[model samples]
Target: MLEINLNPFTELQTDRLILRQVRESDAPEILFLRSDDAVMKYLDREKMESLNEARQLIQDALISVKKNEGIMWAICLRGTDFLIGTIGHWRFDKAHHRSEIGYTIRPAFWGQGLMSEAMQAVLDYGFNQLHLHSVEANVNPNNQASIKLLEKHGFVKEAHFKENYYFRGRFLDSAIYSLLKPKR
Candidate 1:
């Protein structure tokens, strides 16, 4: 495994979107994205209840980046700074050359192909810049859209665990998908 560096680039850009570090100014959008029941429906974590929570989340993400543990980027449209979503890798295991991918988008942006565009940039960063062997994502079995997106990116289903995650006082099933680096 190689020594990982979280701050490899200040920002990443696709044709329609820009992936940049999260900032305090993005709290309102973050709050809205994380608090909306529709947006949080399939996520295992509790919804963000206030702006403070969003700010804290941004701060924590920065800290994690500084520690080389993870990288989180706010997804914004080109020529605009308003955050519409987020995509990132967390739970990085340097020795294993792998990390878990996570993402969330504003409900308004759903079905627009924006998330898929942002994901490609992040995945390229992970495989090409971070030199990771694999990238994994965990999704609720019911989130067919997310599963489809992962599959579109060449990720293959690796496992399905029944009631593997205890969330909101009950166990929930999860599916794990992984995309490995192409052979050299």
Candidate 2:
């Protein structure tokens, strides 16, 4: 049987980044990520309008961890605690030892390969610490950067659904990618 326990909250580390639990104080950074047009461009989610919303998001994320349902982390530099991005594995299918991974970085930090480092840390935790059998990502078809990132990490394109989602009064396409746990 699949087992998960995020109790005590697992903090991850890479050479240049740290993945720590999201805190209430991170509301401003979270707000910027959820609200910024460039950051949320392909997310197709409602923009955050206030810090309160970001706080609520943090609470929800914490609840998920407490319940062992999922986990989210604020990505920061090793030296500075400032959050430059966030990443998580959610929408778990524990019966199959599967989960969906999601992540986003501030627009200012783009093109730095920082996300790649963070992703490696998260994947290490998901596969080794969490014992996850497979991980998946749902991405907007137009997001080539994300597509390339997934590809670079050994995730393979699994499917593409044409106009399967309705957002902002229009239907949008989705591309699914997946990776399996590497053999030891």
Candidate 3:
């Protein structure tokens, strides 16, 4: 069996990005990302309609970290603290050494390859630092950009389930992708 701990939090860095702990001040950015039509287009989750909702989300992220339930990072530029997006590994299956990865970026930042950078860092931490056997991504089949990004990172499509779940008053399909730890 595998046991994990995320005390004191962990921060990741890339040439142009800093992935750090989520803070209350990130509510505005969280609100935008959770509510913006473009950002929420393929997301099956609920939208944040108010700053209060966003603040609650920030709290939830913090609690999840403290409980070792999961870990989330606020994606910001290296020299800044403002969050432009968020990424995390959650829905852990410790018995199997697997976890689900999810991310959301402001539409304004799309096409810049920034999310790709963040994803790579997170995947590395998941597989190398956390000793995860695999990382999984559940994406909306219509989300081509996300599918492409996952593929570029070597997450091969493992399954495509039609109308597997219902969200926002409709049935939606899921394209499941997974990346195994490289042979060592």
Candidate 4:
């Protein structure tokens, strides 16, 4: 049986960012971000119309983390600890040693390379702590920034599905990418 230490879930830090679990109190901040169409445009979920909805979402994420079904880390600036984004991994395939990653950042924090740093930490957790062989990401084809970021991390384009996601009253193509840990 594969045993996970769980220590990494406590907190993760990079030079410019702090990655930690989401909390119920995070509802307000999340709502602020989710209320913006620009931020929710690429995401599957609709813009949060109320704080209650945001609270529910954060509560659910917290529950999932506790159940070990997945992990959602709130990304923040190191010094101020401001909630800037979130990164998550879920749909674990233990037998295959793989999982899928998803991420979102506030528009204010965009173009700062924060997602790349958070992704590196998440990838390390997947590859080293979870002992995963591969991690996959799916991005909307029109989300060029995310495509570039994934490619920067050596994730190869594995599949391109046409109009796979019917979102926001539009058909969206998805580009699937995969990254495998280099053999030691």
Q: TM-score: which candidate is best?
A: 2
Query: Per-residue CA lDDT of candidate 1, range 82-125, in tens?
Result: 99999998999888999999999988899999999999999999
Model 2 lDDT per residue over 1-184, tens place: 7889888898988889889999999999999999999999999888999999999999999999999999999999999999999999998898999999999999999999999999999999999999999999999999999999999999999999999999989999999999999998
TM-scores for all candidates: the values are: 0.96, 0.98, 0.97, 0.92
Model 3, residue pairs in steric clash: none
Q: What does candidate 3 score on TM?
A: 0.97
Using lDDT as the measure, the top candidate is 2
Q: Of the pair 2 and 3, which is ahead by lDDT?
A: 2
Q: How many clashes show up in model 1?
A: 0
**How many Å off is the CA of 88 in candidate 2?**
0.7
| Model 3 deviation from native, Cα RMSD in Å | 0.9
- Say which prediction, candidate 3 or candidate 4, comes out ahead on TM-score: 3
lDDT (Cα, tens digit) per residue for candidate 4, span 129-179: 788888999888788898899999999999999988887698878899999
Model-by-model lDDT, in order?
Answer: 0.92, 0.95, 0.93, 0.84
State the weakest 10-residue window (summed lDDT) of model 4: 1-10
RMSD to the hidden true structure, all candidates: 1.1, 0.7, 0.9, 1.8
Error at 59, model 1, angstroms:
0.3
**For model 1, how big is the CA root-mean-square deviation?**
1.1
